[model samples]
Target: MADRMRKPAEETKADLDKLFLEKSRVKETMSDVLAKLTANRPKDALQFIADYFQSTFEQSKRLDKCYRCIMMTHHSRPVYQQNIASAFDILNQSKLGKGLYGVTGSIFDELITLILQGTPESHIKKMTDRLSRRRYEAVTYHVFHYAVTILAVYKDYLRVAEDLFELLDVNSSGQVDKVYADLLLTQLSTTFDHFKKDCHSGIQAGISLSPDALHTTVSKVSRNATGKEFIDCKHFLELSADVYLSLLQPPD
Candidate 1:
């Protein structure tokens, strides 16, 4: 009897260890989702959260982390992610299924890839220029959110990526200057051709422009480039309401 009892205790200990290990994975996955949420890629962030829940469900066949998975998964939706309090509530709840997780995870994976490809360097420059005109308008707020959302949803939707970047591209020129260029050229080849091109472009452009022209262009772009131009976070909240309402409207 004593030996049998001891074996059961050992088994229980092993189970606890496994459970804790899975919990650790949940924590890491949660961290990853939070990071993505705060990044330029909210959709990708959502997908990451979804993927974690899905994977955990499949592997563990347990509900311990389901609440978080559900919360993050729901929050990834553009509408829900915008709401801090509601998102928090959902994140606080129960178990998710393995099958559901797998499907959602695949969807996110595809979206992320599409968004990334859409915003190539050349496209970004052109799109920024096109969209910069709305900088001072009320529409600018919607436009900014729209751009970010599009980037999130389309993930590498190169055509739309180009359009968004062109709208943001204040310079209206074909190339990115060295300073703004860094946003485009994140990776460096051993030859560094991309970096060199950007550097050369900025220097040449800087030299060619009169100081006044350069200052005007920079001023225009700088004023709205950082997210500070947004009157409040709620600007998007309001816009989303309108957009959703529009979606619900009857077909023309």
Candidate 2:
């Protein structure tokens, strides 16, 4: 009896690793819905869950058309890559971007340190390193597509992604300027601040922006040609998707 070992279950390292991967993926997939459900407290959560996934399924079909549209518009691999690189270039320049102010000394005001606010720095660096074969950095079409595929398999971020893109591309333009994106982010930050003031756990729940930050950001971005550069809608969508994905990671 002493020599013989009996356990209810036995899981080798491989089994445990596989289980962990699946568990992490499933949890990440359900995070948004779970957060929404908790916040809203629907009358029937079970039914709500079912409906959420169903709506997401329909959204996925439309999302597929988005990818198809991108591929079709480019028409060739080289063209697609060139455009993707251009967009990435815009983002790479903007991520650590320093806003300028009236020359007090040799230094610019540095109002906007990073446009991708609140995400892990490692993710931003990794993305930049990944796409940057040269001076510019961005998510390649293959990487973007694969990442989107992962999201689709998990929770279908397509709808959310689409909604964000349309909202950002105000004026219904096929592309949006970096300056405009800065303004939008500033507005979002302000709104979040307002909510934080009203709520108890505001710091944890909201992102805040100072009043002057907006004015300075606008001034700097508007003056720079790169800030005025128009990034393709699909490329912007990919950048935003990466931001959303990075937010899912637990802080180190």
Candidate 3:
């Protein structure tokens, strides 16, 4: 039976067609999940199957999330910075075309309303005013650069912590599993190195995490979270940042 199946399988059976219709990867996600299940070798596969969807993974593939992510990722690049300057140029012209000059508070507010969040409106107004000299506008590539710099990097710990949470929460479930706690440590390390390389942050690369340190943090959070059996990203990052930031060092 195995020999016969091998002869016809190529023609009769098919692998998962790579799903790429308008960024919807439901088919691909299921394929990966099923592949992991086989590797996991759960004793009661049926019960595992029953708990699969119920346990986690509802996607938060929002359009705004995508746009924000793209903008954030590329903001440090020269060409992207140029494009932003050009966009500011266009917006400035649009204001002038309306018999106004410089990027206005109202215009700046409208442009950023969709992409920027967790920032105070008052702070935003002050930013616009600062760039516009307490009055009229938002460009020159330098002015745009300064303003974009703020937009890109000015958030405090609490506000930008959501980005860390979203980074760790692979399924956008707002939490991560205890089983993958070690995995998150790996991800955190890689993310640090990636950011250092990508943003030229001068953090010194090749950062590594001590597994015991991460495990202790995970255990502490799991205790505090109580019965959730999962560590929410907020608690994990907040606590781990304290423990691990000191530990991070350039490879000697």
Candidate 4:
């Protein structure tokens, strides 16, 4: 029976066509979600986003594709502006903000690596053209916030923080200097506060970092690096991925 029932060319073609259609449907659904996310009525968008994340199964497999779609859409002018504004507003305020917040660190890492790997200046210029100054800053803040929050809960936060300080130094300076040190502390503190407020309150207080402890760590790191020499981007990205994955770690 097996020998007599060999698969035909037509069957292979039909299977390929079906697979293509499935992928196309997924892309369209993602596009719709992206649109809703960046649109003016962010509350409705947030609900849809939360629902999508909740309903989706095997999220690990699709995460990269979803992240790429978001980045591509965010690079376009109209969608870029909308996302910048909505990201700041919705992501900074609502509980459903987790949907937007959870995915941005890796996306930011990807963007920074891609930019730095090439002519960074030209790529930065193009980014500036696509996004307004405020929006650009907001997006930057979100990325840092996401990265720091994830790292703070884990054992390697200091290492990753120091690496970031060096990368932003840009001058290949041995030390973190005052400005960048302050910037790192600020990002860490702000994101820590956010988690304390949003993630560690009411019924969801199962997983959180100690605000005072986080602040102390930030202060110590910042002060130690004030005059001390520091050592680094893809390495930081790998560290960022580690931190991001840690967020998904199940509570004991």
Candidate 5:
């Protein structure tokens, strides 16, 4: 009985050791990728990730690893983070749609998680500002919608929700108003549910929010707000940008 008990304990210890070793290896790989990106060799780093993803037999496992690698980039130096974001844009424009979807969607999801977990305000602002200047508005909007859904799904995020509203009400208006607020909330909620459903089974490309659609939504709301205060087009865009910035802050 003693021998049998000792064997089980030893197996448990070995399993934990194996887990730690795998984690360390992953960290090392991500570090290497970051080094290449920072050195202006983004193509090489992307190629390495592509090879790793291709070599992995399990799709889910490969995606999870890819996600971790991309998330790790967010914690890198600001310049490198900008490089990685630019690399993503280049990939999206090239024949690397698979990498773009896997990496970009994961990056957005991770940013939302970090913000909800209480990252610092300044860091988030800097990261989002960088991304916006790089013309990643679609990704930024997607992240904002995700963050709002998280606040909706988990009632515990009520405090964050208040802060988000304040940020969205760009002109310091008391509220987002009923019509425009409802429209924004409904659109975000629907997209969030669809994205969540897809993510449950596997990673999917993020849904891009078209500027035309946003403009139309704003137009309708503005016209409807003839007699009352409402979030206008300019203020709406500013609020969206601010929300994006808020979500980008580094974790505390």
Candidate 6:
């Protein structure tokens, strides 16, 4: 992934100037469109805010894309401050937008940072109250930076995802085994289904299990069942795959 924080000071300065000019042009165009729309029927402030946000994102994507392409620039410092100010401006213009209770600067930071970190618009919508100017900025900034650190350390969210999957796989088999697998399937049917259908298909055929499953499986298989003893990692691996298969194709 391209580094968002690698831009030089000079490049950032140049980019900021260009971004500002483009934003001004877009604001003018949006004003004209809104004026025409409100000519006959009056729209509430929230509706207008929503419209402006949609249009702004559309028009601003060019600049946003450009910013994404380049490394973070010193020039961006001022622009970033300005953007925060603009976000507040939108919030102040709407009645319902401002009436949100418990809104804080941290929340605004959190919401905006999530947006910058590529969180889906739908997810952001689910957090509309927290995303307000007062709250998002306050809550998200530090957390978002931490999220960025995790991204940097792991290289990608999918890698973290892989780690989580492995943690549940137990037995080093490509899948969960019968007992543990059955429990997981019963407890998280939808998640289990989605995991197998989507997430498991591409994982390396190796298994790792959650803590309790590991202890139980080890205890059960070592119970002096004589010929049924599990001796090594290979045994564990086979057990895992067997568990996975049984869950996937249980007899009716």
Candidate 1 segments whose C-alpha is farther than 4 A from its true place: 1-119, 134-140, 156-252
Model number with the top TM-score: 3
Worst lDDT window (10 residues) for model 4?
127-136
lDDT of 2 at 228: 45
Model 3 Cα displacement at 58 (Å)? 39
In angstroms, the error of model 5 at 182 is 1.3
Task: State the lDDT of candidate 3 residue by residue for 1-252, as single tens digits.
Answer: 765667454634433233243125466447755975898888988786666544323112222333344364456466776566556654544323235545554344444444445555554554444434322344354655555544554343234344545654658887866545445555455655565456564243322233454456555555444434677765665543433343333222
**TM-score for each predicted model, relative to the true structure:** 0.18, 0.26, 0.35, 0.23, 0.26, 0.24
What lDDT score is found at residue 201 in candidate 2?
Answer: 45
For candidate 4, what is the lDDT? 0.44
**Candidate 6 Cα outliers beyond 4 Å, as residue runs:** 1-55, 58-144, 150-158, 161-174, 178-252
User: Model 2, range 129-184, lDDT digits (tens) per residue?
Assistant: 33223222333435444332233322223344445446556588776676665454
lDDT per residue, candidate 6, 1-252, as tens digits?
Answer: 345665688678978988897745656566655674677354576676666577446434533442342223332244544444444443333222334432245333333444435433433333333224442233333433332232232223223333434555556655433444333333333333455456553232123234464456556544443433223323333333333334452112
- Residue-level lDDT of model 1, residues 42-146, one tens digit each, is 456658667756754543332223223323433246554454333223322312332322212222222223333434444343334332332112222233234
lDDT of 4 by residue, 1-252 (tens): 874676798678878998897744567568756875777456676687877656443333344343343345423245654544443343333122444433333234433333233333433343323322332133455444343233224323444455556655667754545544554555544554555457544223212234444445555566455444332333333333333343342222
Q: Arrange candidates by TM-score, highest first: which order?
A: 3, 2, 5, 6, 4, 1
Root-mean-square deviation of candidate 6: 17.6
Q: Pick the candidate with the highest lDDT.
A: 3
The lDDT of each candidate is 0.37, 0.44, 0.49, 0.44, 0.45, 0.41
Pairwise lDDT winner, candidates 1 and 3: 3
Error of 6 at 41 (Å): 14
